[model samples]
Target: MDRTESKHVFVIGLDDFNLAELQTVRNADEYEFHGLVDYDTMVHPPSYPMDAILAEARETLANAPAVDAIIGHWDFPTTSMLPILRREWGLPTPSLESVLYCENKYWNRLAGQEAVPECTPAFQGLDPYSDDPVGDLNMAYPFWLKPSVAFSSYLGFRIDDEQQYLQAMATIRDNIHVFAEPFDNILQYSANRAALPDHGSGATCIAEGLISGRLCTLEGYVHKGEVVVYAIVDSLRASNNVSFFSYQYPSHLPVGVRNRMISYADTILRHIGMDQSPFNMEFFWDEATDRLWLLEINPRISKSHCPIFQIATGASHHEVAIDIALGRKPNFPRNEGRFPIAGKFMPRVFGDTVVTRVPSREGIETLQKQHPELVVHVAVNEGDRLSTLRAQDSYSYEIADIFIGADSESALHDKFRHIMEVLDFRFSDVVPTNYN
Candidate 1:
């Protein structure tokens, strides 16, 4: 393809690190790329003018040549923003209502109940702004609570007692509306949004029964209303908290379990009317009962797993997102990459602490030298407070992301364990003092 004539794609939230993986797409040579928003703005935009960011997104795209496609793999704003822009420019993408069916937690559960009740857990939406926020909930204590629109499990909490519930409500009251207001503003433009359960602009949240089992994600895309699953990635969490420790592609799940998950996802995606986009759906499988529970369905590829897919399968799943964006059928690879298995591991600290030290780029380089297949990315600097990291989950702080490949699952974990020891992350406890 000639450079001047290449198709122009505006990737809403492309980050520097993931660019390499996108370059390996089979259609890479046929397109040119432009990035619209950095990660921070995409995650949490300034609140003074909720629609200002969307205006800027429109302006940015307008300045470019006719955009062949608008694509993104980030959740929230990206998923929301993509459909909005597509509608504006008369481009092809999933409808905003379809995306919302996957985003709005309360509505998503409602749709899931109708389409896959066997996989849906008991849930109820709560208005955090109410005088008695806890009173509106039908679910009991020990249930999980989270906002209707959030990313990376930002405000999610597991409530065990009234004290914890009260504490969580207080936090939600102060923070939940930030994303909600903007999401509601976007919904105003959707002709199909009115029929869905009104989530009141995302300020509200949901409390659901806890479903525990082996966690994994199905990565795929819908083309012309057909749901196709390309891969499954195991989401391994830290022993004590909800933060993910690693994501391994070519899940080690039994074939029977994997098949059922794919089937369940197909029914739900089709029922909700999601098409012409990449999707990531999480599920939990109970071994003893042999049941699969739906966690949540996200309307984008899991960007964190892109590199691992490339390392283990020759190409990243970004190919699917890109292909679908351009209105072409995706041609995904199978058993094509260097390693049999690959993982993206997170090294986290579970408490509030001040960073005293972290590995330098040079130090990471040395470790990568030792382990030729390793790629280390540190998110903190010396003297930076861990709590100040933007978009961090309330319970834990991730200091670094380690990507690696191995011949087997056990070897992949062993490699991650060895790398964690080599990368030094030192923190000093922050003495708590009431500031109010």
Candidate 2:
């Protein structure tokens, strides 16, 4: 289709991207851009409520013109609604059944075990009511308790002992709930997956945390059952903390290992029937086994790394993904060109809100002045109440994110540390009694 003749694209989640790129896409000329629908607006507290957002989404789409394509930037609701939108507009998409299976961890594990026998993780379904409610203890300690159909590490915990497991279960019970309402009746479609038992609640899924030495993610597009791996980003984390700190592109994996990781991803996508969408597949490298283990697969472009790819290669993954979703064969190259290692660092916070002083504007400005090439995106503002790292945390506490690019890994690391030192934002004051 000609550029002018192409239909307007409806972006579901606008809050996911960094400021610079978000502005670029909003103002780009390649396609007519329509207004965005804040999927999280209806949900209480403005976090993700999968079913409610999907219901509102169908109504929003009904009022808009027949969009050429529906893009899911980073939100879970956008990913879940792909099949429904395809069905509504008679656009090509993966089967709804396939999308459902992939979205739910309960089904993903069951299918992953059947399809890729070697790639499956050790997991068991927990009954809400049981004397031995913990279920099977097949895997070792330091296991992960996660919700079946969720993202952003929400409702997930690392259990180290019996006491910890009990505490974690209490936390899960207080937060999550299985949705019992009929989604089709309310939305005129089956947009709802498992419902939260109550408002602002979600379901839970637990698993034994794999002994992963390092985390790396692969971004790719699948067409006609064939997967084209675009970029592999190695995640950088703090030596002492479990939260992810940054990501460096042009991964330091051996050729054979990289190829193996791609092969594993292909197997999972094919088995899961994700034939017509973009994916961000995360994996952990086991040092002892020298093997790659599947963590989770996201059905959208991995945000915070768009600029990294743009700088590394002249191509944009966002544009490629949109093209593929619109049924246009993208011009992405098979052999990705290696470039300088880029890093994305998220600010760490200790409390719910920035009750105390946070990162300084001057410090950030100084970093930007010192390193003009770096692309930094700060999400936190003064007095903004930070949400929890994982969904299950009682109080939320993520402050900001910083993206930097450099010639080498060491250079990127040094630049990140220097910036953090300059923009020091941590909790030193006592928690306020009236903190809401």
Question: Largest lDDT belongs to which candidate?
Answer: 1
Query: What are the clash counts of all predictions, listed in order?
Result: 2, 14
Q: What is the per-residue lDDT of model 2 for residues 1-436, given as tens digits with 9 covering 90 to 100?
A: 4666656777665553432453343224656655445634522233445566666767877887667777766544456567677677777676655555555666667766776657567876553323465554555677777666556666667878878777776765655553212222223344443321222112535564554666888888887777888778988664334666677787887778778889888887887667778878777777678867777777777876777765566444676567767786566533342445666776555445443456666777777788775555555555555553333233234456666777788877777777767776545454421111
lDDT tens per residue, model 1, 237-307:
87664778889888989999999999999998888889898899999998889989999999988889888
Name the runs in model 2 displaced over 4 angstroms. 1-6, 16-28, 39-55, 128-132, 135-140, 178-204, 333-339, 349-355, 360-363, 379-397, 429-436
Q: Give each model a TM-score.
A: 0.95, 0.82
The candidate maximizing TM-score is 1
Model 1, CA-based lDDT: 0.83
